[model samples]
Target: MSVAATRRLNLVTEPILPRIRPAIAALAPYKQGKQAGPDAFKLSSNENPFEPLPSVLEALQRTAPINRYPDATASRLRARLGVRYGVNVEQVHVASGSVSILQQLILATAAAGDEVIYAWRSFEAYPSLPLVAGATGVQVPLTADARHDLNAMADAVTDNTRAIILCTPNNPTGPIITSAEFTAFVERVPADVLVILDEAYAEFVTVPDAVDGLAERVYEKHPNVVVLRTFSKAYGLAGLRVGYAIGHEKVLDSARTTGIPLSVTSAAENAGIASLDAEAELLERVAVIVERRTRLLEGLRAAGWDVPDSQANFVWLPTGERTDEIAAAFVANDLVVRPFSGDGIRISVGEEASIDRVISVATSVR
Candidate 1:
């Protein structure tokens, strides 16, 4: 970028707004995935293609009056999740969504001068969350194949490190961190530092050996560890905003202390419980998306794109410097995509009809 037209993501050259922290002023608010035109498929956000489950709707309809405050503790939902994860109710924490919980955890553990580590080009939220806590973010670059570099991440740890976030079946890239890889990486981390396993898309992952934070009970062995899960993706509850965490009781208590009170509504809590009751049907829907993802991955590779083998409901296209150009083509063809300039495009596995158009656009560009 030319100096005259230069805009830095964090470089501060101008006067700060009155009463604003320089750190906060240097950053911009997060931008959501681009919205598509009415006739176009919104393939930018990795949302579930299936409609909301009947159970969730029924639960919402039966919700109590809105005048009264919701159960701030989300007691019933926490109990249900606790039983599902084979842990005590104290081990489960519910919030608006996993991202809210992530922010809460960052606030609880990190502060000025502390360092928080995560793999870059993984999750868009990871880099920005630490900034909110006044902590410096240490971005470890992903491997050439678009997976986390766990070894390098472990080496990046220092005495000032306060927390580390691991996104399995990572967003955009869609590659999972294996169980073996997580275990070895945790061994290198200090016991006092926090390790957050953000498994927001765990329901979509198909690999047998991928990291299972709750099933394996990594927290039982590593008390500093916390696993985050969300209903937004698989349960079609993105609009409802419900997510939960499973781990050590004390660690969750700390997160709760830092959370915004009454953020999880009664409607959201009821829907989460109903979704859990209807998990079998939801898994069936997930199976369909998994097949769609497989088809999309195969077609992209057949079109000569260097796409990653995604276990989640999305695929990555390494369009390099042509990212903007290729993404524009997809948009022109009515398939909105998320593009990171100079890096790649992440197209969500959307409606069945969007599959061919995505591939067709890439083929034409190539």
Candidate 2:
């Protein structure tokens, strides 16, 4: 075509392009942990180093009819979870992962002009979820010790606040909200506002007073409360992608309405069921991880680094301004760790063998 004709055509086509939401267009995409090389210890993502239980693997192998769509409601898994948690099947909701459920819950309750509150530097996804739902994110800063400042979070809530996410054993920083603190905080929150207790790392918690959302049954009293759990970390089913939420039937139904259809696959459901059947063995593996975490914490302390008390299967190093430099050092030693520049580094308690190298690298960096 001639230059004039081509210019006219370009102008017409450009104006026809779909308009993207300014909020979404400005938002950064989610960043996954860096993949490690063959010889490296990938302690970036907080993953269970143990392989899937034999029973779970066998169940996955038995899962057939992949051509068919999965159970959109995940009824069987929900029923099993209901039995375990002492709730009705209607009160249980399953999704591809707890993160997906979180997004669904956010979308269910919050939208433009509403607010969703969470601790800053807790979970990377927390802030993004609300934004995707067209809600404003209100990040309450953590205490100096890296624990959630629940009181501050309570104070930040307004009439516009639609949801609040409490990440127990707050991710990356690694300190759990105690039972007493949680109870008091919940009391302060408005009854109508949704509260999500994200217990993704609950299985690894060894602290005696740490809040157990299911045991507490806060949902029974506060119908707006929801407890989120996952098989990815403890049950070693990250690849399968299964997670659940226990809450009041009505609250869960709202989240269900927002969820993507048939996102949770049959294979994931089967793996979750098999994991439940072999809970004893899987928890025994968690016990090992807890022990390793304890040892790693002690070693870091001995090496002269002031690390926070970590109940989760990871430790946080408050590298501050030197976060990038320290993370680079870890990478040079084949230790792939998650680093938040100008903030800190989160190193997962991975393979037992990786512990020694972690200590060595940490010591050298210090």
RMSD of each: 6.2, 2.0
Q: Which stretches of candidate 2 lie over 4 Å from their true place?
A: 1-16
**Residue 88, model 2: Cα distance from true site in angstroms:** 1.0
Best of the candidates, TM-score: 2
On the 0 to 100 scale, the lDDT of residue 226 in model 1 is 96
TM-scores vs. true structure, each candidate:
0.94, 0.96
Q: Model 2: per-residue lDDT, tens digit, 1-366?
A: 999999988888846668899988998899999999999999999999998877888998978698998888988898899898888899899999999999999999999999999998899988789889989999999999999999999999999999999999899889999999999999999999999999999999988899999988989988889999999999999988999999998998998999999999999999999999999999999999999999999999899999999999999999999999999999999999999999999999999999988999899889
Clashing pairs in 2: none
Q: Among all windows of ten consecutive residues in candidate 1, which has the lowest summed lDDT?
A: 3-12
Model 2 scores what on Cα lDDT? 0.93
